[model samples]
Target: MSRFRYSFQKIVDLKTNEKTQAEWILSSAVNDLRVEEDQLSDLKHHKSEVQETLVSAAANRTTVSELMLYQKYLDHIDHQILNKNAAVRAAQINVEDKQSNLTAKMREEKVWSKAREKAKLHFTAALLKKDQEALDEMSVSRHKQPS
Candidate 1:
């Protein structure tokens, strides 16, 4: 048997809260992903600055106390950077999950649309066939001798 192929012909007819929610979810997910990426960029820039500071401190051969203070500052910056990176990663994961859900929703919508089109076509063809059958019967009866 040949595999069935389907396509949408009346996607415009569907109106439901689910479709509206899907659109909103997709838009929000995209916006959230963008914001997370921007935060990551800012965090990396800050981390780079801290690294530069550490490198300069090392090169200067500062006194022990000053070096210790610099090390503490560097450590604090590193912690903040790590925290920022973690937050960004978590946000990215959330965005990816939401995107996956959105993709599934879109697929569902496509399938539903195709099914609806097929149903419409099937009903229309059936009605046409019924009308044709009726016309054929009427013509045969009209020409037949009384019986």
Candidate 2:
């Protein structure tokens, strides 16, 4: 029997490549999200430490200027936290979008793979039928010959 070749083999390969690329994109997005989340956590931790220091200063013999400075610093930290939160949100949205794209690519790949399998099965069945016909013809020719 001849080698079975899928007519859409190129399409199947392209679909698989697309899926792999999508997976890589999704991985990158996830890494970005993780980095953003870690930065936000660090910012919150720093803000807490500053707040504690400000409180301690207030309870001690700190001057008004120092207190005002601490307050301003706290305000600055708050603004940074807000911006970091926004960044985290945006990264999360990016991850979601990448996840959606990866899902689509995977589906496309599966469709092409299934089609290839179906085509291969058809090819095998046809080959088997041809072989069986050849065998039957040979058997009939032997029966018709003199013993």
Candidate 3:
């Protein structure tokens, strides 16, 4: 008996490769998003520390110039935080896009996998039928032989 071979094996291999590539891309995107979120968190933490310092300084006797400087620094931190927030949002969007692409690749791979399984089942059934026919012919000949 000949071995069963899937007709679309090449297509199945291509789909599997595509799914792997998509997974890699999605992982990279997720890492990027995590980095962006960490940056945003650090910025917020720094801003809070600066605010605490400004409040403590107000409790002591401070020069007008020094107060203005602290205020200016705080304003700069606010602007930086705003930019970091925007970056985090953009990273989130990129992550979502990568996830959708991965999903599409998974679906493509599944379709090919299902097709291969169906082909294997059909081949197996045909082989079984052929074997049964051969056995039936052998039985008929044996019965016709001399008792």
TM-scores for every candidate against the unseen true structure: 0.64, 0.97, 0.95
Q: In candidate 2, what are the lDDT values of residues 26-97, reduced to their tens digit? A: 999999999999999999999999999999999999999999999999899999999999999999999999
Worst 10 residues of 2 by lDDT: 1-10
Local accuracy of candidate 1 as per-residue lDDT tens digits, 1-147: 222334443453353345667678778877877787787687778768877776788788777787788778778777777877787787778778877776777777767876777777887777789889989999999879586
- Cα misplacement distance, residue 57 of candidate 1 (Å): 5.5
Evaluate all candidate structures by whole-model CA lDDT and list the values in order: 0.72, 0.95, 0.94
In model 2, the clashing pairs are none
Instruction: Tell me each candidate's RMSD, in Å, in order.
Output: 7.0, 0.8, 1.1
Instruction: Give per-residue CA lDDT, model 3, range 45-123, as digits (tens).
Output: 9989988988888889988888889999999999999999999999999999999999999999999999999999999
Worst 10 residues of 1 by lDDT: 1-10
Error of 3 at 56 (Å): 0.9
Candidates 1 and 3, the one with greater lDDT: 3
The residue pairs found clashing in candidate 3 are none
Candidate 1: count the clashes. 0
